[model samples]
Target: MDMEGEERIAAPRAVVWQALNDADILRQCIPGCQSLEWTSPTELAAAVKLKIGPVSASFSGAVTLSDVVAPESYTITGEGKGGIAGFAKGGAQVTLLDEGPETLLRYTAQAQVGGKLAQLGSRLIGSSSQKLATQFFADFNKAVVARAEQSVQS
Candidate 1:
């Protein structure tokens, strides 16, 4: 499946980029993310629980960021396993654009699944992915905006 979207954050590109790399901020922004830990400068381990239609599973995953252009763009690749439920692997390319005092965040992602999850059909998978992606970006935007406001207040 493939997904893409863009969001405008009320912060500069550097601020948004910093928040994106912060594990604490990401934990608050990612939907269903139970925990996120940095294993290295460009690698992280995460646990998330998700429900798709009638299927529910807990997934453990590792994400790696590469091809980075500081405060501008990067590629994120990840793979997750949910035991009997299934496994998924995906990659996303993210770009940041300066919009005056705001930053425009855009991303395109592709994923593949196998096992029971794959049996669920494309329509279900596609819709579920879209919903989850939307939720994640919304949460991320809120977090970034809130932090920016707090910083300004302080």
Candidate 2:
């Protein structure tokens, strides 16, 4: 499956980039994120639980960021296994555009799944992926905006 989206955050590009890389911030924004830990400056270990259709499972994954151009863009790649439920692997290109006081984030991702999940068919998988992606970006934008507001108040 392929996914793409854009989000406008009411914060500077640098601030947005920092938030995206912060484990604490991501934990708040990502749905069902049990943990997000940085093993290295460019790598993160994460645990996520998800329910897709009738299947629910916990996934342990590692995400690596490469081709990084600070406050601008990076490539993220990761893979996760859900035992019998399935396994998923994907990569995404994320870009941040400075829009004066705000930042515009653009991302495109491609993912593949194996085992029982793939048997659910492409339509269901595609829609589920879209929904999850949408929710993630929405939550992330909200978190970033809230932080920006708090900064202004302080």
Each model's backbone clash number: 0, 0
Candidate 2 segments exceeding 4 Å error:
none
Candidate 1 residue-wise lDDT at 89: 84
TM-score of 1: 0.97
**lDDT of candidate 2 over 1-154, digit per residue (tens):** 8999999889998789989888999888777889999999999998989888888888898989999999899998889898998997888899999888999999998888888888889898889888877898899999999888888899
lDDT of 2: 0.89
lDDT scores for all predictions? 0.91, 0.89
Clashes counted in candidate 2 amount to: 0
Best model per TM-score: 1
| Tens-digit lDDT track of model 1 for 1-154 | 8999999999888889999899999898777899999999999999988888888989999999999999899998989999999997888899999999999999998988888899999999988888888888889899998888999999
Per-model TM-score on C-alpha atoms: 0.97, 0.96
Q: Candidate 1: lDDT of 48?
A: 87
User: RMSD of model 2, in Å?
Assistant: 0.9
Most accurate candidate by lDDT: 1
Give the runs in model 1 whose Cα sits over 4 Å from its true position: none
